[model samples]
Target chain A: MEKFRANLMLCAGTGCVASGSAKVHAALRDEIKKRGLEDELKIVLTGCNGYCAEGPVMAVYPDEIFYQKLTVEDVPTLVEEHFLKGRPYQKLMFKEPEKKTAIPLMKDIPFFKHQVLRVLRNKGLIDPEKIEEYIARDGYLAAAKALTEMTSEDIIKVIKDSGVRGRGGAGFPTGMKWEFASKVKSDIKFMLCNGDEGDPGAFMDRSVMEADPHSVIEGMIIGAKAIGAHHGFIYVRAEYPLAVQRLQLAIDQATEAGLLGKNILDTGFDFVLEIYLGAGAFVCGEETALMRSIEGKRGMPRPRPPFPAVKGLWDKPSVLNNVETLAQISPIILNGAGWYRSLGTEKSAGTKVFALTGAISNVGLVEVPMGIPLRTIIYDIGGGPKKGRTFKAVQLGGPSGGCIPESLLDIPVTYEDIQATGAIVGSGGMVVMDDNTCMVGTAKFFLEFTADESCGKCVPCRVGTKILLDILTDITEGKGKESDIETLEDLARDILASSLCGLGQTAPNPILTTIKYFRDEYESHIVHKWCKAGVCRDLTTFWIDEKMCKACGACLRACPSKAIVGEKKVPHKIIQELCVNCRTCYDTCKFNSIRILPAGFEGDPYEFLGIGAAAATTGEKKGDA
Target chain B: MPRLTIEDLKKIKEKHRADFTLREGGYRAKVTVHMGTCGIAAGARNVMTALMDEITKANLTDVIITTSGCAGLCAREPLATVEIMDQPPVKYCDLNDDKMRVIFKEHIMGGTPVEKYGLVVGSETTY
Candidate 1:
């Protein structure tokens, strides 16, 4: 075969394709033909380039020139200048934000500089659909090493020395899990990939599978060889249609290449992989529950001691690892345990990918080495909070995780460091919050989600989550009692102690963390019956700020309750008695005239609701008022 | 077909005689277009098309083009980076059809990278 002189790699990942990468490909081919240089320059559409915020990205090989945000019209200039004359357009380069200078190479961007790509090393570099591109990059080299060079024991020892843990929540050591599965004396053994990532606003696994499906496949093959498992399953949520499709295609490609199926790398070890679609149940993320679903049963957690390592799917020894965790296997094997271990902190080796969303400037996927400060991710990588909003809190680990206040912003992110603050490094879902967010409302939302997703198998999770949601809901609605706070703490402890699985055990995290950090917000709700952020509709009453009200009938027209009563261009009076506190007038008032005051204040909703001193109050002495 | 053992894969790599230099000339031009969701939403598709069409129309096979995902400057969409051999690469923001044509003609094929539209200006080695 003739060697191609130059290679042009395009990010054909979903994000880029949706942004018109296909058209870019068409133009490149057309231009190459028009210039009669098609043979010299080879253009290949590859997988995702992790920095999704600046996508439609491409990299030129040998030189490694990185460019961002190109268009159709630029094709002619590209053909005229760079293609024929050997000159690149400086105007289309990537600009360094702080230095305000243009960066020519892909590696120079700070987003790429700080990251030590292990799982994502081949993502943006290879064509996911074509097996040859993957092979060209030494993709299946690790499985080759494991099958031909190392025994099952040797493979396990190498993994053990790597210090890698499950990227899925819980941080269980990967090699130890494999060792236990391998030791179990069972005829049937299974390897499962926990792709049922139900955490809200988290898509790290999806990105990996989409960009590098073969990595996960290669990882699983190695795991099966080590654990003596012949059958494997990738339990992906039904919601991720694209990931499922890509995974299936990858399986077919690997089979064709003899990388999977009967004789993988001619090692005499036979294995087959199947895809199981999860019906959007959050509990299935738990190990036992996930196993049950893979076995075509209702997804629910079962008792431990007879753990999955001993009796898993169909009462066989089984090992389960999340997509991100499995994706790390091949790289560790190929590069050596020490190379993988050298990047991250001592406890957590290798980089972690996070789906940074909500109130952040750069809201997309970020893969950073462990122990990097939260401040760097939030400010430097994420570009700080959106709209110049002051950073308030970052809710890590989803509903099963806790909120870390700004005071903890400087804390280095790792499994143990985050756990020190009572939050787990769950699937890397980091939701940024601003001061405008009401803590009580935020806690209530998480409780509602946990309550709804509970499997109802255990009494503590089913009943306790419901109770927690009710109390949090009451607090957000301004009916909270001081005793309610104590009751919440007590119930959280009870659930933690008695719940059947990790799901229930960590269900109370959001509420407990909010109470720990923002106890004052809860106090104001119980004693003062006021929502400081004015987000809780029931606790607020809208009144016209007489000085600010222009009464152009705008508020009157906008008010669903007809709470504003005044003529045009004149000062409007908000009828306190008629107001339902829906705040329609407040939302409609362009003049910013509407105001909400605490319960006992002159403009308070308590007077309008007619509760007036008859309402129950907790914490304060009865005669204090 | 026999089952491939780990040793077979190793032998294949050891005995591999394929050419390592698939592409020739260190003077090839590179263009990177940011196609993250936000960039796409801001009409990066058109910008990518313009660049490719111009390169094709000019019969410039040495010019390579590709797309990547978000660079975090969401406020500016349709971002592109251009690099010519032996020259600095530059990032351009808010690209449109007209600007793309000028960039393709004057920068990518003409040996001169447009400076005014550049968001970042530096050598490719630093990144």
Candidate 2:
């Protein structure tokens, strides 16, 4: 293929595909071909760009120009004007939401301004299907070094110097794990890549595998060499079909090209790789459980006196690393320990990729160096909370992690820094929550997930989680007493202490952390009988303002319980007894007649409005979704 | 498809570093046309085409022209930025074919620097 002058790189990640980037890609290709500019201008379909909120994103080559939300309709015009006429397309650019100004450059955008990409270095830039592209960008250099030149001791020493920890929620040193596995003196040791990313809002691992599968492969290869393992397995969750498919293809391609399988690079050393499909159990994310699942068992965690490093998969000494951890290996090996250490803090040397989501304007995958403050991620990278809402707190580390309230937003993002706030930086799932989010409801939601996902091997997780979830549910439904909080704390402590695996052991973290930080929200639920965020529908009553009720029967007709009663062209009333608080009346009220009387609401719901009870009830809040 | 030797990996990285790496000096100047939804509506494609035409006409082999996302200033759509190596990127807002030509010749080739239509005085923009 001849070298192209200008390349239009379009995002082919899942989010962008759902948003019609595929059509835009096809249109751009057709337009380029039609204009006979295919020789000079080429189109490359890449993986997820971090700012998914402004997806279907693309960028031009060499010049490094970023574009968002490209539609097929804009392709002809874009080709005509930009490719043929040399005029910038203003309509297709991102406009600042608050400033109402159309900013065409990425540098001016807050979303991409602060991020320092390392693990996600090739994401959204390189075509993942092409192996040459991966190699062309120093992809396998680290693996070659580990295989041909560096001994197992040297590689482990370099990793130790780099200060990278396991990014799978637990911050264990990679070098120590490798050292333990290497010293085990086992002939049939194994290397495993834990790609079973089951966190609700986490997609960093998935994107890494999808966008740069070779990096992970190389990392695993280097790890196998360091640990004296000849065979490796990547346990990816079944839900991520795209990642799995891409990874399988990469494995095949590497094997064909001598990047994998026997005698890689003809270095007189051998390593074989395979993919193990996970059964989509959340507990399988645990290292031992993942190994058990690979061994054709029920994917339950066995107690560890014999951790994977000493005796693991198939009762052989094994080394298991997170998908993100393994991906960093290639870079650290190629760039020296000092180069890796230069990017992040002293203790945590390297960048972290976070699936930045919820209650924020720019929700996408973000990678930042360690020791960067949460304030920078929220305000600088996330563009703060969505419109008109105050930033309340952010949920980090998925279910096993804790919540960080607004007061701790200034804390630096590191393992130690996160632990200081009683939160684990687990899997780098930073879910920003607004003031409108009820802490009680949030904890209950996570408890429900853990309760349902708890493996029945241990009694603490299996039984304790259900009881805790039942209590949280009753609290949200306004059926809790002051003693329930104490009970919840006690039960949560028991679950954390007695649980057999990480899933059960850390299952109570969200509840414990929320109770620790937002105990007032819990006190309000049990004592005041109110949910401040109005998220607990059961704790709030929906009423109709007598004056604002345009006599419209929209609410009355739509009420499933017949709770609303009003005649056409007159005022309406809500029968509180029949009101189940399904939010049907509130959602159906077209004239803004419905008002919520929160539990323990002292003053009249209308009194807070302070208007003639009609228009005051309906000051259409442009609440950011 | 033989196994890549250590020397092959180094050679490939050297060949592709300029494209993937953020550092400059591989190209003379980088011109970016904002191509978000608003930029496309405001004729950024035309601005890009005009810049490309001028670069081709001038026989400038080193200039790299590309497109970018929203400039945060929506009222001023069709944004264009001209960046020279080691210099700050100058964002030129509200452009057309005529303005693009002047930008191509004077700002890009002449290196005289244009500020009237620009937003930021280039400090830390991408290479």
lDDT of 2 at A393: 89
Candidate 2, Cα interface RMSD: 6.1
Candidate 2: where are CA atoms >4 Å away? A544-580, A584-595, A599-603, A606-625, B14-127
- What candidate 1 gets wrong by more than 4 Å, as runs, is A1-8, A17-42, A58-104, A541-625, B1-127
Q: What TM-score does the A-chain of candidate 1 achieve? A: 0.86
Question: In terms of DockQ, which candidate is strongest?
Answer: 2
Candidate 1, residues B10-71, lDDT tens digits: the string is 55443321212222233377787777777778887678667766765664546666566676
Count residue pairs with overlapping backbones in model 2.
61
The whole-model lDDT of each prediction reads 0.79, 0.83
Best by TM-score: 2
Residue A135 shift from truth in candidate 2, angstroms? 1.2
DockQ of 1: 0.10
lDDT of 1 at A456: 94
User: Per-residue CA lDDT of candidate 1, range A1-625, in tens?
Assistant: 1233346777777778778788988997898899776754668777777655666777766446776776677777765555443445565667865566778876676666666677786776666776555655577888888888889899999899999999998899999999999998888899999999999988889888888898999999999999999999999999888789889998987887688888776778888998999998999999999998877899999999798999998989999999999999997888788988887899988788888888877777888889899899888888888753588899999999999999998999999999988777899999998866888898888888999999999999999999999998888776788899999999999999999998899999998899899999899788877775667876665566666677688888887777777897779987777877776776677776666665434533333334336335333232210
